[model samples]
Target: MSFVREDMNIVIVGHVDHGKSTIIGRLLADTNSLPEGKLEQVKERCRRNSKPFEYAFLLDALKDEQEQGITIDAARCFFKTDRRDYIIIDAPGHIEFLKNMVTGASRAEVALLVIDANEGIQENSRRHGYLLSMLGIKNVVVLINKMDLVDYSEEVFNKIVKEYTEFLNKIDVEPNQYIPVSGFFGENIVASSEKTPWYSGSSVLEVLDGFDKEKLPDDKPFRMPVQAVYKFTGDGDNRRIVAGTIETGRIKVGDEVVFYPSGKRNKINSIELFNAEIPESAGAGSAIGFTFDEQIYVKRGEVVTIAGQPKPKVGNRIKVNLFWLGRQSMVKGKEYLLKVGTAKVPVRIEEITKVIDASNLQNAVKESIDRHDVAECILIAQKPIAYDLAQDIAQTSRFVIVDNYEIAGGGIILKDLEDDSAWLRDKVILRNNKWENSNISREERAEKYGQKQALICITGQKDVGKKSIAKELERKLFNDGRIVYFLGISNVLYGVDADIKHTDNDSREEHLRRLSEVSNILVDSGAIPIVTAVELSKGDVEIIETAVDSDRIIKVWVGEEVTTDIEYDLHIPNYDSLEAAVSKVKTLLQDRGIIFKPF
Candidate 1:
């Protein structure tokens, strides 16, 4: 495929009723990029509805959207100037549809944040600005719309521009251009408006025409998320090809690559896109496939990368900053689906550090994150997966949190807490020793208890039957004359002065923050062994394992089957009878060299 140098994506975003769609429609109309019949059809529909002709109606084609005069979803419109061919993404301006805005902005190389010159900056104006920053879109061009409403006065335009500029600066978005344009009047779009003669700046088209696409960061590390795998049988070739869009950097033939989380490495044999085996390399934005020398285990959502670059971390627990979009408030202890790149995984809010009040951009001590609130939170996924920080690479770093089929929030990974294993171990050991020494003399405890064993706690969804099996194992161990503390992790949190149940998203952080405190007490008590049951993901398991030093901890898997690198000392399948599970626990204890005595 021949590479097109002039291809660029641009998203238009702002507060609702700020003429985003109108501006896009005007641009397309002025540039004569719209198909011949499209505009006439839109005009006839407007006439039938008895509604006055609106430039926005040209793009707002959805039934509900036409009734409400609001853009609920991201809409795409294609156009071309003499300088470049552009794919314009019209993002929704409402705070309720911020997720849609993010979805649109994620695909664009540059963004045009539209603001009403008459109304000045609204809530979503600031919000869209913040979101663009979070989405890693640094090249912004502010469009001051509704210049006609303000009498096309230069003073009004300058004042609004100055105020909006200061606000953007506060959020760290340096706009490349601020154009004064009236989308409805078609002024200053393709040509300069006669009304604003004092405004000597270039027209919107001129600015877009002059944009330097070469300045975009294309030299980042190669990251191609496997969207799908193709295998052809009818064409006589029996080879499998991994296919996806190149998110960043470049990949060429014979380049050594690694599939993430799976940790499988292979060499690329050829790069193919639509019947062609390209010679050079594929840059960002190209959708292509490559066949590897060896048949490695490649799955959808797994990241493919060059050999020497820093690998994305594969972990269950992650720390992130989230922008909440759901109508209902976000609460802790609730499970949500996380979609990062192409992989969707079960996730929960382990903690909420702080909730940001969107109206004032100030920290609020709320119990949960409500609609339109931004928050800094820690999420715990059910399994280990590959991810990178947004700052390091936005392609792999950004993720969406989905609740009940709706995208409730969007976030970016600020940092990965997986590397704190060493510190966690030290804290666990120190706390364990402190409890052991404070509770009883070493000699006395040793004489009373034959051996000291660490506790492993598990927690997750209800109906998993965690408590039933925990009691049975405790009974078997106690009958064997071995001291075992079979405590419900929730009971330890509530009954033993530790807080664990998080009702809302804000309090969820407190719940996770208390996990370490409770675990320390159990480990230090010097019980022969401690076993508590809770539903937890592999990522959380790794975190707790590292926190308490897994070498001394024995994690037993119950219920569903999962893949883990941790050496599980015991694996018990879900049983129909309690006695059967108890018997298995007894056998496991015997295997571990514990003597069973009947009372």
Candidate 2:
């Protein structure tokens, strides 16, 4: 019979020595999928060593695993049934290697959770079940292995099914089927076993074929995280192409796409391809590139979705269900790198709402997350990022936390928390959509003024010489034949804050919003708006960034000591001399390419 070549990735997970590897080996042997002479070679080696040959040894490829008689890594194997091919990922069953198991399981569409009938339910059995749910593998089958050891008793099998079913229900995971099988004796795997006559269910191989293949998310909204921006000017081909693999839905030529976080929208001009006919359309799983109708700056790591569809959440803070695996605990206020889709941004654990014990389904209050601890927590990113909720779009919601260059944790975003700048972000999106573009682009104006438009924010303590430094910087730039303006907070209070009473926190936020809006106008005019504010926090700058491009805003903290938690681009310690402070700021501008440097 001709079998379809379509493949599905499936993972086998359970407690250590519960026959996960042996079941995979049996599947290989029964399906005649093993390489020629591989099984015989293993049997010969076992004979020479005076040890009985076992199917588990077929998968224990690592020396450490063989010595310890346990899996240390996720081993992969391929096999085929009469219907389709299967890529079996034999994840390590040891508790210590739970990280490796999670890594393996996250890539699978289906999971086979093995539980030794003789050993009953173990710690890893429940933990693996919980992890399978967290990883979003909805297709599950419980393999009650080592049935021969339990004398193939229906009562024992039912008990295990009952206990495991209860545990799975707590985590909201329902197994597709619970089957009694013995991999060593090869009973109830490829064929039914008479020993378990009361148990009526399909064999392991039969159930595998019955599983539905995970379909591509083509039906969902179009979402593609920009992986790269390609420009091939070498062969007289000056097309600037934005390229990435589509995570969901479809995009066609002439379709309008909006990039998230920036909220920049543009129309597709043409689909670009390498030595082939450019297709009119592309769907999920296609690695495609397209040239836009306008030369809007699209950066790598920005998620692009078709306009008029559901928009993704754009914020700096998110609530997530995370599982930690770092050697050091995930502590609050410590910075780590959050990588979601192609975007990698600095992040910090803001709060741990509850830590869960996967084995017993217990919850605890914790300040830090230890290894293998699953927690529902809030994370604050250094800047805004775009993502969907895990329940909405699983692909875009999943993220990993990197600490000290090592993967420490992974999670799915449950929801985005409205940050301080959320209101400003909404206003900015509406403003951008309504604003008419000038024929003279910002780049053209930058060339004309010999400097890029920027907001050089002079921030520090109440008594610090922020105003003095701002005026000096403006004078220096003016002398250098550049367009510059010094905007004081007092300048806006009389005009913009004329009606609004500065009594509550809402008025304070509105003041900053008005200042940012004015600065946005100055920036668009290709002029530097040097503004001074007392003790500006990170949240203040974030609000300003909503109106202006964050990269165009240069934050300079002028003080003897930093009192607020603001990340500054340049820290001018003790602005004792106006010229000295202004010189330092000019040097920073030159280094940042905001101003042309001396030839």
Candidate 3:
């Protein structure tokens, strides 16, 4: 049988001065992947700096890095062995450059962790190893680099291997291979060394070549986050094609797909790769476009998945395990934008359950996650998003939190609690109860108003004439001698709750928390509140209703029905007619015993 080695991406990760760059340089040099004159430039630069030309100089291409003898960013290089072609991503080893490390590792299939044979496992060495595991890079090769410094002794290598292996095993990172090599002296890289007779093992290149690439898991549920929509017009016919890369799993022609959080469904008519209309199937790592049978609703950042597979939950609240990288400590109630794949959303840290100390992997009693700390917490987004558990699907599960333009933290979703209605309602109610009684008693407030039977919540998509309806309804209710609290969701989300900013999706959890808290205050104060949100999922509506302790919540479905249930689902025939929607809300309120006329 003829076998062809597929393309593989490998990243080299370790602490600074642990020879990550040297190992990559040596690999490129030994494999003859270096272009002619590249090494001469590095040598000439090193000479100008009045420093010896080290192998690491080859990858420190930046002028500042070459001057300081430190790597500030990740460098990518391509090399091929007789067995396979590989793209080596040399990730930064400094703790300050962890974001860069995550950037590089996000695109890699395997990681090579280089640890100093003499220094053993340092802070960043272990830190990068833990992050690699968290990022779902299962294939690892632990290179005990710089064996020459320890006299190439088998006893030293064995001891270091035993200690590091035990540590990694505790963190659930059992490397595929552990090799002793000296990247500086070219020992056990391409050829085995005779210095350590008892260390009988294949060279790094041999181990890499012998690695079972087929063992990597490629069988996941079909998930392709739509990146862009292509329209080839003016040719002959108008064509609209949705294009994106398959993050995981396989999609075949005629397979049913659902676009979310829109919940639009369509069938795959054809799969289109570059210059090819492949008939059969498309798998992970395939960047292709698809022509659907019908022009269903699809947009960028929406996850396209195989029907009947576990659908992504659309909600405001999510449980995540995060690693904070900002210089300032991550505090609760602060807003940020959460970026997952191509989706950028406003999010917030609702609560910090515990911070995991990376030094010992123990839960520490910390108020907030400081720089370079990992923590497990609950994150909530402002709008509903499609996501899976990190354990179930790695692609859609992981996300990055961006504050003001820079990435501050990265995390993986541990659970999706959209279906847990009881839990969701309880959280809202508890938070409301805490915020209550600060001003006045609910009964006293109810007595202050005359004849409003119950608090009603009017919710729908933003700019879907929600504010207009609210104003009209308030006018009708006022004419009927009833006090109406026209509390706009946007007003509360922006004005009274000014602490919560709608800058980006990173502060989503904080936004929801504040929004729900304010809405609860309004409802509990015995006023009819009209709230509007562009994308309120069924889960969010349920939570809001339960929080205010009222079944009077009415949902007007302006667009596609993303939610499951609504007391009054009004899909307007002509949204242009504001008078019709106002008339409907008045009748619905009257039917629920909310008398319009005091007489």
Give the number of the best model, judged by lDDT: 2
| lDDT score at residue 397, model 2, on the 0-100 scale | 93
Every model's Cα RMSD, please?
A: 13.3, 3.6, 14.3
Each candidate's lDDT (Cα)? Answer: 0.74, 0.87, 0.74
What TM-score would candidate 1 get against the native?
0.69
How do all models score by TM-score?
0.69, 0.87, 0.70
The list of candidate 1 runs beyond 4 A from truth reads: 1-5, 40-51, 61-65, 214-218, 230-238, 278-280, 419-599
What is the C-alpha local distance difference test score of candidate 1? 0.74
Q: Write the per-residue lDDT of candidate 2 for residues 1-599, one digit (tens) a residue.
A: 99548889999998888998889889988899988987898899889999999988877642236777777888778999878899988888877777778778888998999999999999888888888898899999999999999899999999999988988888899899999999998888998889889988999989989988899999999999999998755767756799899999989999998888878888899887768889999888888888987666667889999999998999999999998889899998789999999999999988889999778978999889988789999999988899999999998999989999987889899998988777777787777656666767666798888888889998999777899889988999999998999998888988888888766666877899999999989998999999999888987887887778888899999888999999899998875589988999999999999999998
Residue 203, model 2, lDDT: 96
For candidate 3, the lDDT comes to 0.74
lDDT of 3 by residue, 462-572 (tens): 556666777887887778667677766667666866776667676664565556667656665567666666666654554554444434456665544434445455655
lDDT of 1 by residue, 252-279 (tens): 8888887765456778998888866575
Clash number for model 1?
A: 12
RMSD of 2: 3.6
